[model samples]
Target: MSTFGQYFRVTTFGESHCKAVGCIVDGCPPGLELTEGDVQPQLTRRRPGQSNLTTPRNEKDQVVIQSGTEFGVTLGTPIGLFVANQDQRPHDYSETDFYPRPSHADWTYLQKYGVKASSGGGRSSARETIGRVAAGAIAEKYLRLVYGVEIVAFVSSVGCVEMPFIAQMRNDRALEPEFFQLLDSITRERVDADMVRCPDKDVADQMRDEILKNKEACDSVGGTVTCVIRRVPSGLGEPCFDKLEAKLAHAMLSIPATKGFEIGSGFAGTAMHGSVHNDPFVNSTVDPQGKPNLRTATNFSGGIQGGISNGEHVYFRVAFKPPATISQAQTTAQYNGQGGILAARGRHDPCVVPRAVPIVESMAALVVMDAVLAQNSRSKSASLLPAVSKSNPLMYGQPPSS
Candidate 1:
């Protein structure tokens, strides 16, 4: 289903090359402050032509809020958001619909629906994600305010290039924004100094040389993104039906061109014994002033236990395949019910890892916000008896006077 989440449902619509693409967010709580300005920055981050490393398709991706709010606060109604398609090259894709672009949804969409949008891979295009990013930005703001949750994602690999471990790169004394700025600067320098988004200076140079060579030949490549989430609370997921990691995986896989998803110690956990993979809990103090707390000595389970959050950091990785539209000529069929071959002609990213970083962060925010709302609902239900008892002053910390 296009819609996701039981408590915070979001449905995205529209297509590439269409007049506009957008999303409708249902179940957002009333009184939350929201505006078009809050969602615009994230959209701009994912818009095409932001950098030379991405597709040349230029779209301003200006967002417009249509409904579900009065003044600037949400009204417990469906939130509608739209981003117009400013620059489109429909003629370039006029013939692509009938023949199907290689490694794209053209064939699968046809097999499923018998018809497809004739321009720019239609619904399958990355353009559709504009709505997702916009909605995610709102979700992210809510999550941060309610739960103090923060998510950071970046290009960990492009071709053979990879960044350093996040822990090593962090500064112990710096604040959040400062730390992020440091990281962003380092990352940008590494990417700008070379074509690859890798943080390793030497490896980035090598990756750039290789990508430039391939670009010259009109081919493309793919890479992976690593996301780290901090300060996620405990007990934030339904056990079997709607596990947090499962929900996150579904969201990530739904993004266009995503091929794989893995949480902490994912497939590699198979290589370890149960004893090694387990996270052993220890009695601990919550803080300098708080009561005793539960803590895990290891995070082999990736901050999740029993399909629910364990109040630890959540870490994951997503893998994307090379852009399907390669300059190399390949054999295929034509719209006239005839067989032939065609070389893809268009401006496309040789590697998508750089652009995918923000997309991954956006999807993560949506999942976290949904989980937070579910947890709040459960907390209120479980505390009804306690709340009633507290209201009766006579019963406060006392046995029944029978």
Candidate 2:
């Protein structure tokens, strides 16, 4: 269960306070240009101590490519990646020895594993997501070079503050081309312009203020991350099971602190009648390659219909809860279920939404890359079928009579 994806198998190792944290990415197509430089950008974005809104754990998180490549080109083998932990203060989390933090994984981990790491939350810590972000960077590069696919995620909401564009789009019940155009135009540069990562300056300022206020009160906050995947082909998912949206949900909920997952209209669609919810298909103009495409007048289906992609932009949102470990005193239980007062004393994020943007995009890329490989294999297998008809008889010279 630690590994993710069918075609792109990513196995992560190490823990929060361990000597290192890294991942192994297998099944990548050979001859692709890859290096530590290609994998470091996302790692930097996911690293802590970058801003005041996150924890003050100063870690360089420098990634080293241990194997599976030479001359900066992939060899179609498992690529090993590692990043050493520089600022692991195990003593900061020693309090867990006495009491389990409220709503934290401390108790559940001990119950499931019988023994848990005394420092940090071990595999349950958000630090473990470094592997996903690193491997996802590789998957994203392949998707971009081969399929022209693009994935972007931003802080859609922080606590009660919501981005204006998202709120307006939801209120108007319309997804205009201009809106998608804006969504497509967004770059990591713009999203990272501020510490809050909202891409909307006014709202980002407010979100930052909210986080600061929470930090002032020795508390924390949570919000949502909205991701958009563009230029994905129409037929990249299975039908009966392993639906695209279902896979997306599985990947998202697996992220630490993720509480909810929604695609397209999500929970809001239940309010509208089927007539309004259904996307009316329309003919799409030919692309530069002179290939015909399909378009939908409405995208309530979120670019996927019948559990597969329809060549429209795939968009979704993830809900994250506040950091459970807070400086404020909390009345929680101990390992023996004894109640006591506890005040968590360690570096923690005042708000996680600002840092979750890259994580959401990375997870989305893994899902899409895996689905594309499956679809490609299925198409090749289908193409291998010989021309079969009465003219092409099997076994004997006579065709089977029906």
Candidate 3:
């Protein structure tokens, strides 16, 4: 499971307190321009100590491209990447020596591995995402160069303070027309204008206060990240399973602390009657080649239908739980299976949604890149075969006993 994607495969290594963390990205198209500079921005975004809102673990998170390219061009080989971990505080986790931190991986890690790291969450830590984010950046470069796909994610909420005009981000309520408009226009520049990363200034201020409030109390709060991938070519995803949305959910939930996920209309579509929920198709503005395109009048399907991309903006949300390593005293149990009070001590985000924005964008890029490569491979292979119309009997079912 350390490796992800059948086409653009990525295998990550190292641990939270390890000397370094990084990944080997295979299947990048040879001759595409790439280098450490191409990957470092995202790693910086995912790195700790960005602000008071995040952990004080000061990792420069500077990525070094160890191999897989010659003079900034990928060789289509396994690309080696790594970042040295500069900050270490094994003593901070001394509390974990006795009691397993509540709601953390400490106990389960021991249960699964028969042992666990002495400091930090080890492989389970968000630090592992360094590799993911790094690899994702490479995929993103290719996606943007060939497809002009733009992936953006922002903090949509923090605790009870949801971004204004996002409708509660609940599953039962469909988004307003204006929300879709916002989805089409929102940019990372706007989202990153503030440290909280909320697009709206007022909302970002509120979210900042919320995090600061919890930070001061040695408590934590959870929130949601909304991501939009625009200009995605249609016809990605598998039918039986591995649907685009399913793969998206798989990627999003893989991030540490992610608890929930929803796509496009998501849960809210359920409340509407079929008549109101369905997205009606229409003629598109057409591509530069003047080929007519099909599009939805309303995007309740979230730019995907039948588990495939529909040439609309693909958007979704991921909800994260409060950081489990809150320093507040909690009545929990010891690793010896006894009752006790565990006051966990560590540097963790009071709210993770801000820092999670790039992580979300990176994972989204990975999913899109995988789907693009899968569909491309299939399309190229199919192009060599004789064309068969839908009217052909074999197209309907297995041809008359083979």
Backbone N/Cα/C clashes per model: 0, 0, 2
TM-score for model 2?
0.93
lDDT of 3: 0.89
**Over the stretch 312-400, how does candidate 3's per-residue lDDT look in tens digits?**
99999899999999989999888888899998877898888989999999999999999999999999999899877745666544466
Sort the candidates on lDDT, descending order.
3, 2, 1
Expressed as tens digits, the lDDT of each residue in 136-236 for candidate 2 is: 99999999999999998889898989876556556765445665676668888888898898888998889999999999999999999988899988898
User: Judged by lDDT, which candidate is best?
Assistant: 3
Model 2: how large is the Cα RMSD against the reference? 4.5
lDDT score, candidate 3, position 1: 78
Angstrom error of the Cα, residue 39, model 2: value is 0.4
In model 2, where is the ten-residue run with the lowest total lDDT?
388-397
TM per candidate comes to 0.85, 0.93, 0.94
Model 3 CA lDDT for position 261: 97
**Per-residue alpha-carbon lDDT of model 1 for 204-249, expressed as tens digits?**
6666665666677788877788777788888887879789999899
List the candidate 1 regions with Cα displacement exceeding 4 Å. 164-203, 286-292, 335-337, 386-402
